[model samples]
Target: MRYIVLFLHLILFSIGNAQQLAGHVYDKNTQKPIEGANVYLDGTTLGTMTNKDGYFAITAKNKMPNALVFSFIGYETITVEDPFSYDKNFKVLMKEDLIGLEEVVIGSPLFSRKKMLAAFKGQFLGTSKSASSCKILNENDIVLHYDPDNHVLSASAENPLRIVNNYLDYDIIFDLSDFGVKYNFNTLEPL
Candidate 1:
């Protein structure tokens, strides 16, 4: 009799602890559904992506107050706090990041293509073990610029940045929608 009572209590406890968070992601400016946006519980591995209709449903075992983080490339990340406090259905709006620039110009004299490649090589590929074997397959597709006044290095590509990391054994194709690297103008040091 005691075992039966304990089993029932466990089941009821589990049910009470489980929470379902459902929501749709939309663009704040366009009011359009944002598909492929990642939705995840803050500080937990539980995550899912928005479907074609920008709808997502996540089951969280932790009933304690937690935030949900929504992120997508080229858009600002949004966090909803105390998600469990709200009803099951909710909506999230993400704004596009406009401050990111596609290109930059440094001072009056421009850095030659060779100089730009040399400067960016170490910073982009890194000097770590995994970066040693990395290679950029299509160098010509990348356009690089530097702004001396603002001390910023920005890049844009006609196509995605394709790279192969031998040490990590991964091929990464990065979309350069808006990317920038900041540096100190006086010392020409990375910031």
Candidate 2:
């Protein structure tokens, strides 16, 4: 009888601790499903993407997450805090950002498109010996901007940036979602 009660308690504990979260993502204006939107728990690798119908499901254990982060290119990022407080089947509406160029402008007097590209190459390609042989094939596709008020430099790509790394003998393609660097206004130093 004691063994039976212990086994029952273990089963009950396991069942109680397991949690499954399910949801759908949609366009706020169109009210249509948004496929391929990234949905994940903030600060954790636990994540999944929306399917063709914009539906997603994820499992968690023990405790509920503090927040869930939803992100996609050309769309605003949405963060849902205390997600477990909401209904099991929830709908998230993501707003589209139509103006990519205006959003990431470089306003510093000392920096131009040419200078921005040079700086980007140095930082992204790295200064290591192997990085010397790396080259960005489609450098023109990258757009750079600097916000004077915030002292921030931001970049985005119209398409995937292609790179030929001869040192590593690898061809790389990158789809940039977000890229930004904060700088000290007075010192012009990266922060």
Candidate 3:
């Protein structure tokens, strides 16, 4: 009978079979949906492409979690799993990789200028501000030899920070500004 056959098919299909997952992929940088992107498991043949609308849906034959690798030209590759990070369909969010930074070194140095250079060097070597054993000069040392070009003793021995001459100037101005008042002062010495 037709009813019997249909019922039998339904019973067999319900025997712990697979389910389809559905969702969309988006580009975080352009704030637009990405279409026609490739989504697939790392070591398996299971995969699909985003629709014209950046939507996707696919069922995993296996009930296990799978690493889905998504890729598109001009964008970073996206890897995703189901809500539980396995063999299930789910939405994915991808971010752009930033490629630039702006850096500016301000002011000069003090204590032979080379000492200030040593301080900056210290920062790179995991030296704490309160470190007592910091070696500025020793068997393996950094010396502050006078640079004729810049008149500052530095590792380069030339072209010292101009702020060195105005060290007290910066301090005087900053200290006065802390009073919630603005008064011009010429030097670090009390006027």
Best by TM-score: 1
Q: State, as a TM-score between 0 and 1, how close model 3 is to the true structure.
A: 0.41
Q: Cα lDDT for residue 90, model 2?
A: 75
Q: Write the per-residue lDDT of candidate 3 for residues 16-40, one digit (tens) a residue.
A: 4765667778887665788888877
Residue 157 lDDT (model 1): 84
Per-residue accuracy of model 1 over 28-89 as CA lDDT, tens digit each: 99989999999998888889999998999999776756688899998999888988888879
Q: Which lDDT value does model 2 have at 109?
A: 64
Q: At residue 38, what lDDT does model 1 achieve?
A: 96
Which candidate wins on lDDT? 1
Residue-level error in angstroms, candidate 1, position 168: 24
Q: Please, what is the TM-score per model?
A: 0.56, 0.52, 0.41
RMSD of 3: 16.9
Candidate 2: tens digits of C-alpha lDDT, residues 1-191: 99999999999999898777788999999999999999988887779999988999988875565698889888999998988777879799999978633453335465777876766666666678899899889888887766677877778886999989887899989996578777778223433
lDDT scores in order: 0.82, 0.80, 0.52
lDDT of 3 at 135: 35
Misplaced by over 4 Å in model 3 are 1-7, 10-16, 81-89, 97-191
> Which residue ranges in model 2 land beyond 4 Å of their true spot?
1-9, 102-157, 160-191
